[model samples]
Target: MYGKAAICLTFVILFLVSCSIYIGTVDLRSYFFPLLQSPPVLRSLCATGRPLRVYMYDLPRKFHVGMLDRRSSEEAAPVTMENLPPWPSSSGIKRQHSVEYWLMASLLYDGQDEDEREAVRVSDPEKADAFFVPFFSSLSFNTHGHNMTDPETEIDRQLQVELLEFLQQSKDYQRSGGRDHVIPMTHPNAFRFLREQLNASILIVVDFGRYPKTMSSLRKDVVAPYVHVVDSFTDDDPLDPYESRATLLFFRGNTVRKDEGKIRVKLAKILAGSDDVHYEKSVATPKNIKMSTEGMRSSKFCLHPAGDTPSSCRLFDAIVSHCVPVIVSDKIELPYEDEIDYTEFSIFFSMKEALEPGYLVNHLRQFPKSRWVQMWKLLKNISRHYEFQYPPKKEDAVNMLWRQIKHKLPGVQLAVHRSRRLKVPDWWRRKR
Candidate 1:
């Protein structure tokens, strides 16, 4: 009996220790959240405390990056370091891996109504084995309250209204294995980006919850085995996908537009100017398809600047390409801040700083290689481990919805253990 008691005590201690450890425990809550979800942001935690653990559902590391005219790999070119960033420095883990069992399912939201991304990833046109529900696109800029006269904002708001209405109109979800899966989006916060990703994962998604009168037209009325009730995501967080390569895009012209051509030109300049940087670029797509694992292996930062966007795909490409992004957008509304290591994980040059080319160049030139390297490694580890706290990308907003449902209809309890008091009474004989 004494031996058994000792063993149980040891086990209890181990359990408690594990519970207190947040390092590797994947927080499913963050997976669906982007940085903007909560206010009075989680900035200092990443810098001061035990790091925030995350399940990074990042893309495979070898997707070749090239100019738009020569965009995406062609499957024919010889992959070389000239085309890719430096390999992630040697913690010795391969970046190309799929955390198969832990993932509930992957979903993509283009926010442009462009199904091409989906079309490229999946094969079947009609039927499906594992399929993703794509949100057609984001609202126009004017609609988002950016500027009253901004037509784009107006369009953005209209889409939000329409999407919200669809959610409210729904009473319940479609019949899957005979269950009432639908839940109410009934609140204003329901449509936030992170919430969107959750919504996509949930079974019953009220399509018109935002539109009070239009709540009658929930889309699940037509589509299913209706996704009304979904199993909550398991916190099957994967290890980090360490990245150590950098890609710099330097723009030389003031006439550069926000379009792909301009972006590519800037990218080429950065790549061309780069030697210790190790990369290559071009003005073409489809043909520029190249992936040199070596180049990605040796480098560490992607010098990002918008030829013309308040934000651009270059940032996404950084996360996707597995390169630490050096951002230049100040007004950028990055989705999730708390879960990421953006504390200089990404570098931001305010508009004034970037405009002064000589000063910017000199500052970077003056930056100690050791300091830059340390910053790069720190961010690389975070990106590899933490799912960037980004706003829900299209369907990701659907993800945010599941969170709401889980909140509204809280689930059953899991294993609950009472805390054991560790007594050290002065009157007692010293156990030690």
Candidate 2:
């Protein structure tokens, strides 16, 4: 009997030990598995939940809004939200290239209700993810030298020289070698005086038509939309849009252009004499802009051939008007392309296809009415992404541009870190 009891005790001890081991294994897994999974989740939360912190340099008014008002250079005080000048109402087509002004004004805006902003202006350089250089390059080009040969062109040149001097003296610029700095040069010739000096920085440009591959590429630069010259079409909902629109295609602008834009001249010839088409050679007077607005609103599709550049403000105007755009540029770069698909709302044609007589209009003529209506609906839905205004709205052009900048930050950070210890810059290029 004693021997039997001892065997039972030994079995009980073994069972308890096995139970303890199983419980310990369960506890360990419960403690460590979450620790392993938390990193990526935490990182995603930090990245998506937070706004991009930007440090804007305290530039004098002359560099930005001061150009709008012709403020004196001796006014040394930095532009503030209270002192910031409104964009001139009379600024016609120039307003299309005013990305620099809006970006600077966004940073200056101190409204308490701007909780949805994608970028928040920070005073500390160390906390900033990027730096903004708010020189009004486009305005300077428009104001000082519409005619390049004028003596006042020297004023634009001097502004660029002064801007370079100011940036060179900043330690933040030296730290990243201007790789992290943002400069807006939206005009084709905005910073022509010293563009080479800024080749390393993140350029805010409209297109790569004028720039060499080395100076600007999609890998580093952001292609911003030109603020549409025509106003947005607010009441576009109709019972029978396809039937109500009388015209098949509409194009009203300069006919003669250079490079790939030469297709415009060919198109003007091919599209001539079509009763359903309105092709006019016109300048952007107030009356012409109004007429163009009306034409786009009533048209089934708007023709967007290349202008001086591969992309033009007319394409954006078509988008905001809820008019389906028939794009003809082969080398155009679009804004927010990472998230927005152009094929959903616009039609594409190769230059050769567009230039061919009858082929261009015949296809558009046979395009299904149901499909055209679908594209028009899509255009109306996505048009908000292109609007740029003060007290910037969520996901509008200004905020959208900041988000694009955010997308580039990871690549910028990788480059900035790699440059710090590398003995020879661009060694990978040399190896290739």
**How do the residues 193-295 of candidate 2 rate in per-residue lDDT, one tens digit apiece?**
8898998889999999889777898888999999899989999888999988899999999888888888888888899999999999998988899899999
RMSD of each: 19.7, 11.3
lDDT by residue for model 1 over 293-343, one digit each (tens)?
A: 223333345555654434433453354334456665554434333333464
lDDT of 1: 0.34
Q: Rate the local accuracy (lDDT) of all candidates.
A: 0.34, 0.86
Candidate 2 lowest-lDDT run of ten: 38-47
Cα misplacement distance, residue 197 of candidate 2 (Å)? 1.1
- How many Å off is the CA of 272 in candidate 1? 9.3
- Count residue pairs with overlapping backbones in model 2: 0
Best by lDDT: 2
Clashes of each: 103, 0
**lDDT for residue 271 in candidate 2, whole number 0-100:** 91
Q: What is the TM-score of each candidate against the true structure?
A: 0.35, 0.86
